[model samples]
Target: MTTELRNQEITIQPEDSEVVLSVERISKKFCRNLRRSLLYGVQDIATELSGGKRTSAKLRSQEFWALKDVSFQLRRGEAVGLVGSNGAGKSTLLRIISGLINPDTGSVKIRGRLAPLIALGAGFNPILTGRENIYANMSILGLSTKEIKAKFEEVVDFAEIWEAIDAPVQNYSSGMAARLGFACAVHTEPDIFLIDEVLSVGDVKFKMKCHRRLAKLRENGTAFVLVSHNSHSILNICNTAIYLAKGQLITVGETEAVVRKYEEDLCLSGMEKATGPLILPKKSPDESFGLDITLVCFKDAQGNILETPMSGEPANLCVECFAHKYIDNANLGVVVKSLSGENDRVLYFTSASDNEFLKISPGNTELQIQMPYCCLIPGAYTAKIYIKSGVCSFDVVESFRFTVQADKTISRCLFYQPRTWKVISK
Candidate 1:
């Protein structure tokens, strides 16, 4: 597949077969104010009718671009994951592809039948029963009456709403509606599926079932574009990923790399929020009588600096400081505190005094702490560094924050311990 954006054209030539979807230089704009938005809509329609092209580059009052020059391609049997923070254009792009909305510029060409689970029960009739709604939704998705009948029981069984299949859908719970909608979409057997975070609405067991069904569909050569915040699901289901930030495409490549980039962005964003406008102290003559903690950072065993560390991984904490004058009996202490509602819990603590006292000169210094395995459970942690000169507090800084991401397969607690189990009696 080849995608070219410079010429405002995207072409996908499948090496072995046919191109399933091609998105050209797509762009979308929106207005912030409701009145201006309605006026802009009327003007856009009028301009289109008059055969006058309105450039998206020109932003009128209250207007902003939601997507700019976005382009990609998907071939037969390929799955691409769309990942981004909120308002990053993931949903807008999906809606554009699903034909629920139109882009202000560029074009989209999709081959074969398309089924979009962009919104849960987006097309369902409240007055209709689940079984009746199934027929309506599948028909809208390009399925014939006979085809819907053929897949009727399969959809109902997969949804696990047999008791409520004949009941009015408006009376069903959100999960039930989501399941029924998802079951209908997937059972229609479309050539391409555009899903936007719908898998997260169902129960865990049903979600697993959906994953299994998607895997089966993939094996049968159905292409998919999935928008989800769940990294594990994206990494497991897609070979390619697209990362978007602030309505712009940041990167598009292998799933692992893209997901890592997206996560790194999240970590940096959180750190920015924590450290905004806080200036670090520098070495100066006036501060000669005391110690000053300047910077603190964490790194993994592989020597990559981490803004976000994974739970149960080895990490190294490095603290940089400056001593303005010579001091005797100086001790440096480091504390890791977990933050929760109206409370702080000390997860780890250490002091240079516990090992050996330090004699400092008028210069910069660095301290390194190694954790063979950082078993602290996944949560936000703040690192506090302080200096004490013979029981007198010299200096302290307590504003560094880092997050530990939990492993999806594991049950997390305050900490993790390695253990072994065996059927000794057997």
Candidate 2:
């Protein structure tokens, strides 16, 4: 098969001066070592050099490409988010840009000083005091001792570790270490910043402060490339985004659009129903009395329940149940989960069985429910419908999945709440 980027030459033109960084057809390859022990590396090399017939079993290695011909450019003052599942080369790309490692085939053009917060406290000395470690990190990032001293108080306050600054860095908590690293990097006046999932380290207020500082830097023409799995964080901060899957670029566009697509993919993956019934296996005919859940469905408005819907669209959900024996009052409920299996948001839930028709005697019966539009965000969500016949809650349906998509052209996620905005002359 022809290479995806074979026709495109990997080069950055001088006329594109506004672009601060250009990644040109970059690719990274790593050998997945079947044996990770210390002796394996030396033994493998020796065997290869001895001219012995190399069998596949003896080699026990495969060339794993962590990034495949990825190319993108960031102009001055642009903030872009790099999104992907774990091991999708987000960190590898960041390291390549930060000059920590070299790509196998492609080139990177970076204009000015790059401060990379790729791994928090990666360069810090654990045995040293936090103050000394701060100085060391600042020096590594190309700051003079006098400059660090001048900005010392500002950094300390910004990190909110004024008390711990004098203590050994080894004694600091993980969050404190991250804050110190981030604080030092932000003060380095980097023209291009490479951040990898460090914002989730600190407290909410500190994160807000970091955002403000980054905003100011952005206004001053600083370009930032961020990598995170949190779509909400990306939607709130980044203008553009790139989604990577299995070390290849899948989608790259405005942040909101890429986030929506990523979420939709996740939801579709989980939409397949479980094998047996809607209830768990433990409560099936093996253990519990002769009570069964027949069918469960997620619906949209107009009496049509689709498995997935785009964000801001009207939708409906329904659950059908059947009882083998006489059943009394029952409580029905539903829960929603994010694409990563974290509880996303509850669409609708009810425990009151006011209507007696819900109390089925036997055979088949259908219970329908409706949810209006604009409730859930543009991401993958799962619905866990439950019907409690006895004292405890029994699964009517366990984590039925659905996806919500959004328009790619518009940057609307959190701000898409149903509210009118009026603009007047200030």
Candidate 3:
């Protein structure tokens, strides 16, 4: 593109001397049909050759904006994670930033050298050996023959694919190529690193090594714009995050808050009526079980509905179950699950454990379990209820999710334990 488009030049704040990358009001569109895309490509080429500018502001038929009005700036020593659902244009934004593709409108300004692991194995020729491909990529990165030779052993060691170092790249699996690409990029120590989800390809050990390397680079003030579905990785490596939805910027802030919001949005999106206040509709009962879980919610001691409760604060678990026929005795159990992890079972309690049993009637029965205070840490959780008789499950309710806001007296933690300390030892 033209120098006028350099680094988006939107604000012209060179005196700041910190901002390393800037994307200004950028947008890009793609055509659905391959033939139409190629035709449009040729037409644009012709127009450019004839000194005519194609209007990028408007879209042709079968075209949709892959990214729209996206803008952000990355400073030295900042690692920003991009979290979004599939087809959210995260990869498209990375490509544009890496100069693999250009935006239809606006421009991107990158102040220093960039190393992109956006498309692993993209530059390797089928017939070329991995060794040869590594040399070629380093050469293209402005490393001389001597520098490339010096770093060859280091790259292979980091990639952990030395056994196939001399094998043709065509014989390499996607994971192998990705590991090699990641190894090469990090070893070069570019000023800015554009990482997509290629880190997800390798084994856990290799991924750990990658994270360690990224940590070192971050410590040395190398900026990163990483796109990944793995929030755990993002939380571990990034201090900030950006959330995107339908090619639009949703929120940009501290990594924990942004990731949490994105995840809750995903959970909320799957339910009916994504817009209105969070009230779940009654679901049908299992005909075989002859019971229905009509409503499950949380409330305070005052009986006011609490969408989110405070951590380590008093809360009430309320459930309304409709029993089809009268039953002699039913055992009620509730399972509290932590959503931030892989649906981990945090707590489970049952009325049977307390030597109590419910006599089911042929109508809705309200059950309320009051807790002195929730001891769980601040995070998302779900409560699941099940009604059983002897050993047979009669009713099973889906999880109802809610967040526990951090108590003013406490902070985010793994687990909460009330304790007191003394200065006796000191």
Candidate 4:
């Protein structure tokens, strides 16, 4: 990689200028059942009605740790990515930082006014018109009437909702509401910002505007804690990244390194789960069509099963498919699923031109497929590999299963080519 390509310089401001946000050993626990407490209440009432005072009744419940001993600090002008699998405490951490939820332990120290975009339409009145909702949201975001009035046009323009500015928010689509909420949040002149994947909404143009606004704020020493599964966004913008799992921060480092680690952890966990001997599904002999997979692995540059690789290195995927018949013209493909099961991002598909089509003459054939590194982000992603010969195209398939990790050290940025930035100071 050229110096210009590999070395994407980020301006590092002084770290001692009063840490904008300090999250120290914070943890959050939740009770699973409210009905248990209700039952205890009824039991206590029955005991008291018998003319005998009862001691405190135990509340049957199940405990869940959403966060545990997670610590990090954000100096002014710093941006950090909070990433994790679903139920990995990414949202919980954001909620705690936004003060929407209190932590069970430790503390969050935040300085200056904060703008949180954790939830779309969190403060908006659904029944109110878009104009009224904007006003209400701005007020809740600490904007004065005069300030809202002054920036009203800019907000509408940024949100690209000039035509629907007067419509009720309830009538707006989810994207429209998200755009409005994002507009209101950015309008507030805040020293700290907490965002949770709100940029995934709206169109590309709106997303660009949001990125520009974030860049402007970041240049002004406004710290940000962004919770997102989109590694590209985090890598392109954030100075640091933290990966959380099971309510604990598993990794933290420079944006590039941290993203790579997060992807690695995801792959490792999935592999362990898939490789455990007891994961085999029970089979009933009555079922005629039964298929199983074994020895799923990714290949390095030299066509070897690769467990890990430095960023920017070459890699490929190798999986052996076992079929029970002479399947011809099978469409071999792989679908990469996120850990959260939100959506499966297609990694690769080959019908006959993958140059990898194999004809099984009533026997099992080892099929190896290769994919370049540019197609994936540096994160843990699961894969579903299959061979389909009929219109069904799913004769031998694994949906919502399998896992593969991308190697990113080969690139300067996280997954894609690094973008250029020009710094201008008056």
Candidate 5:
């Protein structure tokens, strides 16, 4: 692979296929202990210099494979999203392709110029101003001096950090540094672009800008290998997805299919780690003079308590609350949470949020809210009962458990309507 990425000597070879970047069974490993890591590095160097190859056939003590036998090919005008939980080697793979790191086995063949956005501003000189660093960074990415100067204003402008351009990079905030780094990488416009969660940092607007710019790059036949925890970003930007788990490829196919498979694994794993019922605890107990939640449950149309509610079907949410005093409208709601635990992931059935005024009089009461469509991806979930007026009138962490049984429709989308999380990772 004869590519022109800075500090990389991968020469492009004629391919029978028109792939832009080909990652063939790439694998990488890291030692947990820093001392062992340094020692092993020296030993490997010495062994190789002695005309002996470094052994990497199996795991060394205190070492683990961050990536193992992963392979993929990116064609021009296509984007592939890398989706996985943390420690899944997404970043490691990007570093390997970018030539920041090398794989233990297999080969990476590139057919054109490439840009790797591993850690934003990683190559920046801290003492230099942002403006100066841009020149240095882009130059290292294969830009000529004249080209850098020509695109100087555009880079700063796109980064939205014109005011900070002359400031020392070390003084810039994390967001600022990330913005400048992303802008520089994108402007390079290489045939293949590798991004590793750098987009997860910036604010929403800047992220939106990044997405739009990435779309433009795609239009120009740039292929992307994007590592993102955000399923929505992946679905929006990539034509396909590769799911990695514990350094192994789980699935690689159409974006939705791959994302759903990843989500299913997350749900199953969260459930395995969860204690019984997965109910969220109420932060505080209900006031004696306020409302009290008696029960919260989901039932099918037949009025039978739903043992396992399937996705994409109608179910009724019943919230039974007892009010101590008369109130014109007491906000009643249920919070849907994954079995994984506290993350404040909630779906509002509140009378206040939905403008359904509930007249609560002192006594036992029950309100059944109709969920015409349950968009929750198949998973074990717990719901919290909440009744609020001025303060949290009544909220209980205690509850029964419900499982949304997986179905073919679980592949609905990254953004299931109402308030939904694609997948909650522990």
Candidate 6:
């Protein structure tokens, strides 16, 4: 069944469509002070016992909203990524949906069984062996002993802990425990899965294995709600994404749009300390030098400004600057680097000097760097601009950020290159 969310209202395409999960006007609150919180909790319980209305709208001492009127739906075979900063109510929302926590207002309707892998080693008993914990956890998940026994080998195989299945779980490494938990959750074969950053616990090989298993489950009509800080994984797995901030739902739509909006918010929120690269001195163009970068944009092949570009598509990086002074031999450079701020992250770097030095007169000037086809990999990237006159640095701006989505055919390398493969007599 097709599912759509507009203005917090969930609509299924077909009249008889099956929705695996539905959240309506869900909200949660918390109090900062422990003593006051306990008192408020007791008061709320008393009010409930007396059949009186609970005061959820009004805030008491040190009370604040953890989630504010959030609503969404998930259908079978659908995957949604939750994106936000710390304390953005993502985890709280997931907990509410998983039935681990109740909302202060509104309700959640889940039609089928759900498996939540929220915290690592959450349900496992430290004193129990890995194998014994598997059975115990599955039983707690509402599975019968026979059912757990039947799936025991499958879980062990998936977790790849056969050598240590008999060992106590307290001795297992974090990754091992995470694998066991994930294996148990997936092997239960629930209709809906709620995951919160657990896929990042294991090694690369195991993570990929888990991703593949999740894809297979989706093919079998399982729905997923994934919360992760890794935007790449969100783009890779989820078709839709929801962005949250300060306990409020900011936007929910296509995955790329939501992720791009989240990144923009991060940049505006001053979350990333280091800006993009600076080829020259860090000085305002209008102060020390005589150039001011007014606008920076990325445009598609059709000349339409693009917020997100597709990999292998023709695009242009446009930089507009206002020059207060004239210069004879001024050089303009543009560098594209990964947003992680790690060494060796510069994907592409070039300068006007590579072709010929740019000679700009005084006043406003626009520079367009044309790419026949953008070959950069599919990920977040930042474009840094620099202008220099001979040995003196003029201006620099390093705030421009953009994301690239991979084409239909998966290209995993740093950049795509034109080449043909030929076999001469194997």
Q: Which candidate number has the best lDDT?
A: 3
Please report the TM-score between candidate 4 and the true structure: 0.73
lDDT of 4: 0.69
Quote the lDDT for 267 in model 1: 47
Most accurate candidate by TM-score: 2
Q: Candidate 6's residue-wise lDDT over 52-103, tens digit each?
A: 9988877778999999999887888999999988899999998887667778
lDDT of each: 0.77, 0.72, 0.79, 0.69, 0.77, 0.77
Candidate 2 has a TM-score of: 0.82
Model 4, C-alpha of 260: deviation from truth (Å): 3.1
Query: Least lDDT summed over 10 consecutive residues: which range in candidate 5?
Result: 275-284
Reference-based TM-score, model 1: 0.69
How do the residues 186-267 of candidate 2 rate in per-residue lDDT, one tens digit apiece?
9998988998988777788888888999999999999999887777778777889998887899999988778777766655
lDDT per residue for candidate 1 within 1-426, as digits (tens), equals 234333323333433356788888888888899998898889878997999986667878878889988989898899999988889999999988877777878888766778998887979999999989999999998889999999999999999999999999999999999999999999988889999888878889998999899899988989999998766567778989999887898999987668766764664575555422223767566754467777777777776677666666787876667776777677777777654212355565656546767777767876667887777655455667777876688777776766666564332244667566878775
lDDT of 5 at 315: 82
In candidate 4, stretches whose alpha carbon ends up further than 4 angstroms from where it belongs are 1-16, 35-61, 270-331, 334-346, 354-359, 362-364, 370-377, 390-395, 399-408, 411-426
Better of 4 and 6 by TM-score: 4
Clashing pairs in 1: none
- Clash-forming residue pairs, model 2: 299-305, 299-316, 300-304, 300-305, 300-316
TM-score of each: 0.69, 0.82, 0.80, 0.73, 0.79, 0.70
Error of 6 at 351 (Å): 7.8
**lDDT (10s digit) by residue, model 5, range 1-426:** 364443343446638456888888888899999999999999998997899987876888899989999988889889999988888888888888888777788777888788988888888999999999999999999899999999999999998898888999999999999999999999998999888777878899998999899888889999988887766567767899999999999889998778766765665574553222232322223435466665566778887777566677788777666666787877766777654222336455667887787887877777778878887765445676667775745555444456565556444453245445697789
Clash count list over all predictions: 0, 5, 2, 10, 7, 0
Colliding residue pairs in candidate 3: 7-108, 7-109
Off by over 4 Å in 1: 1-17, 270-370, 374-426
